[model samples]
Target: MTGKSLADYQKEYERIIFFDQPKKDILLAGLKAEMEKQFKLPTRSKEWKNENQKVIAMYRKICITRML
Candidate 1:
C-alpha cells in the first residue's frame, strides 16, 4: 500500500482501539487479515522489506496490547 493508504488504515485502527463501541474483536481480526493479505506481495526490495517488517511488528504490538 502507498503511504497515504497505510496512514488511513492506521487512523482507522486507532479509532477502533480508542473510540469504537462494539465488535472490537471482529474489527481487529479483519484488520489483521487484511494486513496479512497485503504482506503477500513480493518483498524483493530492501525498502519494501523494511516497511513490511514494520507493519508486522505493529500488528503484533496491537495484538499484545489487546490481550493485556
Candidate 2:
C-alpha cells in the first residue's frame, strides 16, 4: 500500500465522520491536541512510529466502518 501522511488520513476520516462545521471544528481541535500530546517524542523514535501507525490504522478503520 502507498504511504499516506497522517494529515491526509485525518482529513479523509474527518470528511467521512463529521458533517457539522461547528462540531467538526471543535472535535477536530480536540483530537489534534491529543495527537500532539501523543506525538511529543522525536519523529524517528519507536514510540512515535508506533503512535503514528496506530493513528493511521484507526483512521482507516473508522473511515471504512463509517462508509459501510
Question: lDDT of each structure?
Answer: 0.65, 0.55
TM-score for all models, in order of appearance? 0.60, 0.37
Model 1: residues with Cα > 4 Å off, grouped in runs: 1-4, 19-22, 41-51
Give candidate 2 misplaced runs (Cα > 4 Å). 1-17, 41-68
lDDT of 1 by residue, 1-68 (tens): 34335666687688778644457766777776676666654346788777677675667765765665
Query: What tens digits encode model 2's per-residue C-alpha lDDT throughout 14-68?
Result: 6735456556555555554454555442245776567578774654455345434
Q: Which lDDT value does model 1 have at 41?
A: 40
Top candidate by TM-score: 1
**lDDT at 25, model 2:** 52
